[model samples]
Target: MTSTTLRGVTIDYDDLGPPAGLPVLLVHGHPFDRTLWAPQARALTGAGHRVVTPDLRGYGRSGVTPGKVLLADFADDLAALLDHLGIERAVVGGVSMGGQIAMEFQLRHPRRVRALVLSDTSAAAETDEGKRFRNRLADRLLAEGMDGYAYEVVDKMLADYNVTAMPDVAARVLEMMCATDPRGAAAALRGRAERPDYREVLAAVEAPVLIAVGADDAYTPVAEAEAIHRLVPHATLAVIEKAGHLPGAEQPERFNAALLEFLAAQV
Candidate 1:
């Protein structure tokens, strides 16, 4: 557990593995904290890669200021984090909303990213309908609270196999969502609704890109990953079976294996 001040906001992050090892930054999605990367961090560190996972402004124990947070704000916070840690560059990865932030970070600080690992995410921006839906969700969260949202999405978050066979995993995810501060979560949703399409950004990514998604991801879906893989100049794709949006926790072994293979090729 460690902390840093970025743009007047306190950012909470976990720094693992030897300082001299190859650096990799893993960002978590909305309604979740940095702890979401625990499974992957352990695996990556054990494989000799330096793993850094940080909680974005609204989530976790990081800054909880009341305001609209642009996706670029998340990117700037990441750049500030790397600068604070004296890191020149790293392999950046994220899932869902975190993946969108990763794209924003790469666009904001190109020289700081060596490679990209986009998991269960998309390259498209929020559609007008999507924005309206998200705004309604934000309003609901701010008005009613996270309980309704958490319960409603828990089943949607994981695959049917997970919801049935992996009750503990499902429960943990629910806890993470329910534990989130309503205000912060609402702010994140509002900001996310404004994220721009990254397909054009993918065309600009010259670094190695590994796009992985669950075979049964209902939200991002496999086709979204395919679209990203097709757009990135240098990209590879992996699909883990029996997993949903959060494959890192649901299918860590397969996810780690694919990620390790990619990292090995780089280092």
Candidate 2:
């Protein structure tokens, strides 16, 4: 793990694999940390790709900001990280909120993107109801802390089978959520509520794209992935069976296989 100051915050990230290998930056979703991509990091590193996974501003060991944090803020932090590492370009990817951040990054720094990997994310703007809900959740988190919210959404975060059968994965997910700072998480929620629509952003992408999702994801289902695929006609879509929101963790082998194949053929 390495720490660097970017945009007035300390960002914590892991730099794995050989220095000369192709760089792959993987971003974790809301309420989760870089550990969410541990399996993928190992697999990609073994396949001779450099994998950089960062605990976005408030999630893991990184510094936290108490108020709202725009997706642009997160995107800029990633750009700064690449600059810090002297990386001119990379295959940038993310899951859920991270995926949105990846899109924002591509929008802001198109030349720095080699390819895209968007997993279980949407390209649409936040609905009015969603904004209200997110604001309410943010208030709840700031008032109550993470325990209740963590336990409440843990099951929803992964497939029911994962919660029941994959105890270790379930525990890790829960632990990451429970340990997150409420102030940071709340700030993120508020920021995410104001996110811009990215449908046009998706249509403008020129890089090779890989869109993967869990077949059973309730939050961002297969249809959402299909929508993204349609926007980027050249994208390769991979739907992992028996997984939910976090397929990369619920079904790491399958997720890693899809990712490795995409990197080999596309980027």
How do the predictions measure up, each by TM-score?
Answer: 0.98, 0.99
Q: For model 2, how does the per-residue alpha-carbon lDDT over 138-203 read when each residue is reduced to its tens digit?
A: 999999999999999877799877898999999999999999999899999999999999989889
Q: Against the correct fold, how does model 2 do in TM-score?
A: 0.99
Q: Model 2, 253: alpha-carbon shift in Å? A: 0.4
Off by over 4 Å in 1: none
Task: Residues 138-240, candidate 1: write the lDDT tens digits.
Answer: 8899999898888888776888678878988898898889988888888888888899888888899989999999999999999989988888999989999
Query: Which residue pairs of candidate 2 clash?
Result: none
lDDT of 1 at 43: 90
For each candidate, what is the lDDT?
0.90, 0.95
lDDT at position 175, candidate 2: 95
RMSD from true fold, candidate 1: 0.9
